[model samples]
Target: MDQNEIQFSYRARDDRGVFEVVPRVDGTPLTDLIDKFETDAGMRPSGDAYGGLVPQFFRFGPMEDHFHGRLGDAKTPLLGCECGEWGCWPLLARITTTDDLVIWDAFEQPHRPARDYTGFGPFRFDRHRYDDALGKLSRAVDEGS
Candidate 1:
């Protein structure tokens, strides 16, 4: 999530009682921009405690299920994974109830260096950012406006 990077904001609906996160980046009109605060963090392999460089990206990175308390909470929502694909670069996703499309400035995610292939298993995505998002949602709920 970068201020200069253009991202397509989308809200997922309960398609058959499931939250399907679909990215909408192409074919969208533009206008005066709004400021939205969304964030993400990445991981790179480090040592030989687990696996290797993970040669293949997961099919789906971390994402929200669009249910329960919020995207991140005690819920511990997973990040979108790029399953064994060439162009499967990890991404930051926003999970919403309605399909409200909006593009705005967001917090740039942390830069994670590629992990050293030392067979240290797979790298784990950061939890602090996710926890913060959940915290924001909780605060919104607490305000009770």
Candidate 2:
């Protein structure tokens, strides 16, 4: 199967004084991608209710036992509420990694379990490239840029 390229970029809302790093898949914002899927599925767009998680939570890799509670086995919180509280609204996905690939699939809206996100993604990425993008994000965060 073909893989999607993943990249991380920062967005700053000067009016709200909010700065965050957002994930982009295949050159489009991941949020927009999800919105497109929801729209196509005849569901209401999530709009501003959700946003990317804070930089610190992006520890992308194989699923582990350490991920419990709101993040069940193989799942990680990818996007969270714009209000800065993750539990309020989150877009979670099962993330699994192989030696050369990272896969994100089985998306869920914990707050709205009835909403099915079955066809949204099973996005695959080259491990090396994904790691490089993550490294860039880490450096940018450390530099406060």
Model 1 alpha-carbon miss at residue 134, Å: 20
Worst 10 residues of 2 by lDDT: 61-70
- List the candidate 1 regions with Cα displacement exceeding 4 Å: 1-20, 26-69, 73-79, 84-90, 93-145
> lDDT per residue, candidate 2, 1-145, as tens digits?
8999988776664645656656799999887888778777777646666776554444433222212223445577777777655567778888776789888889998777899988888899998888778777766666753
lDDT of each: 0.24, 0.70
Give per-model TM-scores. Answer: 0.21, 0.81
| Candidate 1 lDDT over residue span 77-101, tens digit each | 1123223121232222232232322
Model 2: residues >4 Å from true position, as ranges? 55-73
At residue 122, candidate 2 shows an lDDT of: 88
Query: Model 1 — TM-score against the truth?
Result: 0.21
* Cα shift from native, residue 13, model 1 (Å): 20
